[model samples]
Target: MKLLIMSDSHGWADEVVQVVDRHKHEVDELIHCGDSELQVDSKELSGVKTVKGNCDFGADFPEEIKETYGSLTLYVTHGHHYNVKMTYVPLSYRAEEVGANLVCFGHSHVADCFMEQGVLFINPGSMRLPRKPKEQTYVICDITDTEVEVSFYERVSGEKLTDLSRTYSR
Candidate 1:
């Protein structure tokens, strides 16, 4: 499965929309970690999986969400409750509790992706208003039964920042 992960748009509907439109053909699902800052009924997010952020006031968004695509269990959240801006140890533990193969989150405006304990932890950062590493960034998680290939993308020109891929052993 190919999943396009995004976070922290903060209401840049055009930017977010453009990104999705650009990659919709290759990805099977779209997941938004949060901080959209747009109404729940916003057209830009019409067919995507989304969660709530600390800034998503009054929107009917859940604090966390779990969804299964094929055999992969995904856990998603905004990470404000876990103090994600500081540490991910607690968040990692929680992902294990939920048996999450991929834990997705946002809130720091920083992009990151890594694998630990056979699970993938991905933060797509903010598509707008980024604070670290780049002006805007996100990740595309391409997965299969034997491997997962994750690559970060810059909002400008859709360039790849880094490629982090892993293969599983039986």
Candidate 2:
């Protein structure tokens, strides 16, 4: 399965739509890790699974979601409640409790991906207000029985950032 993951758009609805349209056909699932700052019923978010961030006031988006695709289980959240800016401990515990194999979240606007204790954690960064690396980015994950490959891309240009790509053994 392939998944497109993005986060921290913070109201760049058009950019979000453009990115989704560009990759919709290649990914099996679309995910937004929150801070979108769009209403729950916004057309831009129509087919995407999203969570609520601290900035998404009264949007009625869920704080987290768990989904199973094929043999993989994903735990998605905005990460504010888990204090992800400080540490991954809380988020890791929650993912474990939910029996998730992959965890997706965003709060610090820093793109990152890594494996810890058998679970893969991904943060796609902020597409509108990036922090570290100074790149507006998102991620696409390709999953198979033996490995998971993650590739980050420039949000506006849709160009893959090969330097940020990673492949983890599953």
Q: Could you give candidate 1's per-residue lDDT for residues 10-84 as a string of tens digits?
A: 978998899999899999998899999888899999887899999999988788999877789999999998889
Q: Candidate 1 — which residues are off by over 4 angstroms?
A: 163-170
The list of candidate 2 runs beyond 4 A from truth reads none
RMSD of candidate 1 to the true fold? 1.9
TM-score of each: 0.92, 0.98
The pairs that clash in candidate 1 are: none
Best by lDDT: 2
Q: Candidate 1: TM-score?
A: 0.92
Cα lDDT tens digits for candidate 2, 101-126: 99999999999999999999999989
lDDT of the structure predicted as candidate 1: 0.86
Question: Residue 124, candidate 1: how far off, in angstroms?
Answer: 0.8
